[model samples]
Target: MNVNHSNITITESACKIADEICLPDTYLPRVVVIGGGFAGLALVEKLKHKEVQVVLIDKNNFHQFQPLFYQVATSALEPDSIVFPFRKQINGYKNVLFRLAEVEEIQPSTNTIITNKGNVHFDYLVLATGTTTNFFGMDSVESHSLGMKDIRDSLNIRHMMLQNLEQAAITCDDKERDALTNFVIVGGGPAGVEMAGALAEFCKYILPKDYPEYPSSIMNIYLIEAVGELLGAMSDKASSKTLKYLKDLKVKVLFNESVSDYDGSLVTTKSGKTILAKNLIWTAGVKGQFPKGIDEKHVVRGNRLKTNFFLMVEGYKNIFAIGDIAALISKDTPKGHPQVAQAAIQQGKWLGNSLLKIIKDKPVKPFEYKDKGSLATVGKRKAVADLGKFKFAGYFAWLLWSIVHLLSISGFRNRLMVGFNWAVSYFTYEKSNRLIIRNFKPKSLVNETEE
Candidate 1:
């Protein structure tokens, strides 16, 4: 948004109301929301026509449907299908303004946010900063392994996977080719299992057709979990079925094993086993990410900020945190709700309406999460789903999985395109798009000056 004036200092400190960043002065309470993930989008949707000034700040200009990122990495779906522009999302809402800036810090003293652009004051603040890949203090893993948090992260893995296959196709050394083809995925949760399934499908169908030189037998996929089983949160029947489906695809499932170390080329396991691996995808865990000014004391387990039943940040009433960043403890949920899209969206809608109720001095209810269900696909016509006590696996489960994902996607165009792509793949057993648009080189290859 273009402004005629420059920055206007609101207080004595660094806080200033920059005309370019902040909206026009209004009598209504201005709510500044940080982050544009599932939770932030849900909140904005609820407060679009309400009597509040909403300003959303995110580093990226779009809202990404994260659950389908694995499909993008596997060449099953295009990136544009999973990404939605923020401006188009709230074009009709005059009270809401979108800002593409990174928040540097939150100065609660002045009720302002210090961003890379300038300062912006807010009567109420909501942090939905979501989660980031947690290496768990493993520096080597942080530097060497690839992550899949956002579009850029997912694309990096895609480029690296295709590049490795290209390198393996022409390599003379057997060991070198094996290292290039050997894919190791850490953490046996939904992300790990889904990635392994996608990669296995690519190895099974795409590789043989695209690169005839390298046999599919040379390619290996490993899924290592620190726990004794996969999908620890799901029912035992669902986990067992998913595990069996993965094994049927020839994926090496290592339970009760953790990766001790990975030195760029070799993976050393705690179980004294060594595997040559060049691509190690870490889907292990994620923790809440936010700007400064929140006291470390309020930060609880899983990097979440402790919140009251009403989703207000601990020790502060105006500042609130929802989604993965909030740790709301109740008698039912001893810990916070699960870090899923459903929980995040539900909390966002609840808080948005609650904030309106607060403005009107009306009744506001406590936030609660209802788990609709959880589903994960292993490979073609193979999946497992759990809805309360009901657990099932196989083709019908896969159909349910596809329908759920299709509905969850942001845009109708994206949903239609993804459905079409899935149909093509199902009938022919092949991936349509495998073109690497931008070539990716490791940081070791790209000089720091260029970077």
Candidate 2:
């Protein structure tokens, strides 16, 4: 039966399964991707207009630029400037579709996925669900701290910092004021480093102007890391330079420290050290997130799905994994590829280009990751970059960082807005409007309210 898959429409080819998601019936292969992050989006872009129907499912309708999330957290950039709607991204792609749904489970035997809204059947399935903050069973810290994994977390940090600052001005108790103004950011990775840098900049440039009643030094910023050095993945030169940069900004860097607990106003470290900080941001760790149903044998450390060189999940024919949720463990990649955007994007592009060949039983090359170096910035005009054998730090590195991130943004409008904001801030040292749109409460308080 030779059917024209390209001309299929919703009305002409309605899904007949009871309670199943309504999708166009096409004879062409249907690739269901369970995420809209860098990996999934890159795959979708590669598959657009191809002889396949690509259904992208994500909890949010927009794709968040995660690298700049700290900027949003510290009011350096607005949320809208870093997020682009999926619909807008797939506007002209005729063969692509976007669905807003949270996947609950994956029934591999039936080749179906169960979502909160409905069920979706797939010819091929790709898990790019990414990772969530790993609290390591620390209930108190998880409840009291904010994790920098998404846009909402950024907004929460912003509101928490702003609200706490405002409260500091209103309170008369010295200890309470100190706690409210102090910030403790856990982790020495890129997210934590960038966040600490941005917050330090805010204290340096914006604090005195906005809250003249108090000295600029009133707001203390502390960055805690479990390891001895910052940015362990980068070069030593980059790491040392970064440490110097943060020290120049007066950011208290505490190495060989790990958070033990947080009570929303106090952070206790494993070494019995305690810091009074109402604002706590966690960027320490992340674990893979995906719908349950895969075999435990195929799962590895970090709760990630184990895959072969071809990026196909073991013990499954048409099931694959990518991005942070995937652990393609091998001799070369002992811990799987680094859970960074570049690796995910490359995996997605590789899979997208090779999937059709895979389906047709044709020869395809094994996935190989290319290291494009690492870049991190600390406040304005200070950054670090390790490109191949060349490692550098300072203004040129910062400029390179800005250009790379600006060009990497999804939409032109977003890029323009961010670029314009950066230009204005470069000369004037100003950030966007730090408006508190909604009241943000800690998880403990929210749970208490529910109770």
Candidate 3:
């Protein structure tokens, strides 16, 4: 298969570049993956010893640990702790090569994949581009809100948060100070809940120590969700426990309250109540970031491509979609599996084993999702957990969540550092490194877009 990277002059250069990069190739049975997120990282790591030539391409070079992204946003952890360099992570693997480029398209018809850098031929393709925050096509939310999907977004949060606090410190005006101190987090997902809790802690426990001039009592954190409860995926017990914990942490929980629109200064809820603030964090819906060439009809709910039992695209054999991008079109998971790291890791490992079996002409085992459990932390000594039959909440649950995350981190050094930070924070109730490294403006889209 031959591919060309060119498009009509009417399209922008980036769009054209993406178009050209989507072509297929005819050479070796190359395994090309898009996106360097959890799913792609899992795939590359699992396929490290495979005989096939594997090329993993992503716009960014690091794989982000999304679970702790909220901590980074709220100054609990550093960016390095949550993100590992992709090349460094896969350096020991001989077959994998990491490329830093945006995949513009996927032209599976020609078996060639086009990227910003050039074209790559693939025998098997995995679209693990993952998902992006979906503001439900709301233009105001899309343009004026902040997203915490990756490292860059976390840094932006850190920057904006610090800047806001500093600006609020100097102001004696009550309205301006209230607006600056007020934080409206859109979405009641784990990210939203976690962020709200962390920010609340900052205001109640941490920020009081840092900014002694301004009263922490004026600082307010609002967690708005269109749904009736938080942690919707978890059990009702977990949800109830989490709600109580958040309330205890002083997070203003807004249930069944949807955000109508957001300007840079104010967040207007669907209930018509307006929240005046400079920061609006969006952790709402997320849609799969699939590569082109697949039929739009195959794209199901959540923007995920419908995949067969073996994780192969419904109408294609050589192509596969995994993680958040793959929608298992089964009655059991009509909408698809939750876009979590565990699901992606399982899919990647299954694909690796399945590929080996396929080369020897063996039957491929169907992918089965094992739901280990779910956990979300509220502030200090407060968390909720759902483990199949067993449920835990409060301090014990928080401890469990901490231990699990520490073990799940990608690198040994990161694990150590994060553990140390957690210990320090647990003891002090203050994040060690709250220094502002960069000044970020919400309008700085090119610089602040999450990787």
Candidate 4:
């Protein structure tokens, strides 16, 4: 049978080889994909009709749209709108199976993964395990700060913000009430910037109407960044514009500032100034979510696995890594590609195609990333977009950002729901996910930075 070289090809010989494994009493070459994040999902999707036996696994059942995680934290969009089921994402793919399991360790030499459930033997291993919030080894900060990585983390912050307002309303002591009303967000990334803007909007426009019992003016939102500016990855124009928008919304923007310490209620800055706040959200740093058995020395800067240009983990042939977990040791990206969804998705797609070629005994091409730029939404009708040659900031940029993200979301339902929420929120200047369905208890909070 003749085969076209244009489309991705899995050779008839490779197909026959894969088919032999599906035969009874024979060991099949299993391709195990760990962490069902953007990278893992994209990889699995691309291998839908491939010959390999694929297994996709993650700690959580649903794949989170991490870019809009801050929106969930600030109650701009509900958790449902940003999360989609992993099984549903890979449904009807006979070659693929989904597993909800936390990986304990990766034994690359034996091509095995030891998870909480059991050990999985693999012919080809993909470590798309992603990353975890980094507290920079500060236990005090780690224990007290709120992170927005998952739905639970987002909902926890949501509860904390609402609970703080409720507590402030009833507190008779002036100092205690003041502490309850103050929110300190650490880091100047998109999450911190967006959260600060959202909190300010809530206090400025929404809080007074919702909590008439308390003075909305008393609520203070502080965005502290160690760097000199916000959105450090974006263009200077975008960064400056976002800073202006945030300040205009009444968010106290502290530049070149770092949180030296936090004792649950007070945030002490590097400059020796202390801010009293019951809520301290950490959007500071993230490290790779490496499994247990991997040698700690293999983890380089940002706790990422050192990989080659082809995204293969160092010292291993069949074992590969992508997304937040993989660190390409190249002159171009000496550290690694930015741990963004686009990088992960692209790498995943590339890996899927490369592996198919390898299985068919064809030369595998080295992966090269095509930069598509970056964008971040600050608040209602305010955003910044940096499209390499073309950079713009403001309402038009915000509209573009919304459209891009809405289309990029995994499921159709999520896109529709998020689109609807945005339209309604834009028209009324109101967010629908503001209801406090459950009271937040400080003791019930789980640290999102648990590694």
Question: Which of the numbered candidates is closest to the native, going by highest lDDT?
Answer: 2
Q: Report the lDDT tens digits of candidate 1 across residue range 1-451.
A: 2212222223333324343364566666789999999999999988886778889999999999998888888888889989989999988787788989999899898898988987789999999999999988887767778778999888888988998898998889999999999999999998999999999988888888898996898889999999988898888988898898888889999999988788778888888999899999999989889999998999999999999988999988799998999999778877789999989999999998899988778988877788998988887798899988789988999899989889988878888888999999999987757877889766444544486
Task: Sort all candidates by TM-score, best to worst.
Answer: 2, 1, 4, 3
What is candidate 2's lDDT per residue for 1-451, written digit by digit as tens?
Answer: 2224457578634666667889887778989999999999999988888888899999999999999999999998999999999999999887888999999999999999999989999999999999999999999999999999999999999999999999999999999999999999999999989999999999999999999878989899999999999999999998999999999999999999999999988899999999999999999999999899999999999999999999999999999999999999999999999999999999999999999789788999999999999999999999999999999999999999999999999999999999999999999999999899999999999999999
TM-score of each model, in listed order = 0.94, 0.98, 0.91, 0.91
Give the Cα error of residue 208 in candidate 2, in Å. 0.3
- Give the clash total for candidate 2: 0
- In candidate 2, stretches whose alpha carbon ends up further than 4 angstroms from where it belongs are 1-6, 11-18
Residue 100 miss distance in model 3 (angstroms): 1.5
Give candidate 1's TM-score.
0.94
Tell me how candidate 1 scores on lDDT.
0.87
Residue 39 CA error for candidate 2 (Å)?
A: 0.4
**Candidate 4 ranges beyond 4 A from true positions:** 1-28, 443-451
Return the clash pairs for model 2, or none: none
Clashes of 1: 0
lDDT of 3 by residue, 298-361 (tens): 8888788998998988888888888888899778987888889889988988887787677557
How accurate locally, in lDDT, is each candidate?
A: 0.87, 0.93, 0.82, 0.83
Clashes of each: 0, 0, 14, 0
How far in Å is the alpha carbon of 76 misplaced in model 4? 1.5
lDDT of 4 by residue, 422-445 (tens): 888788878865778887655324
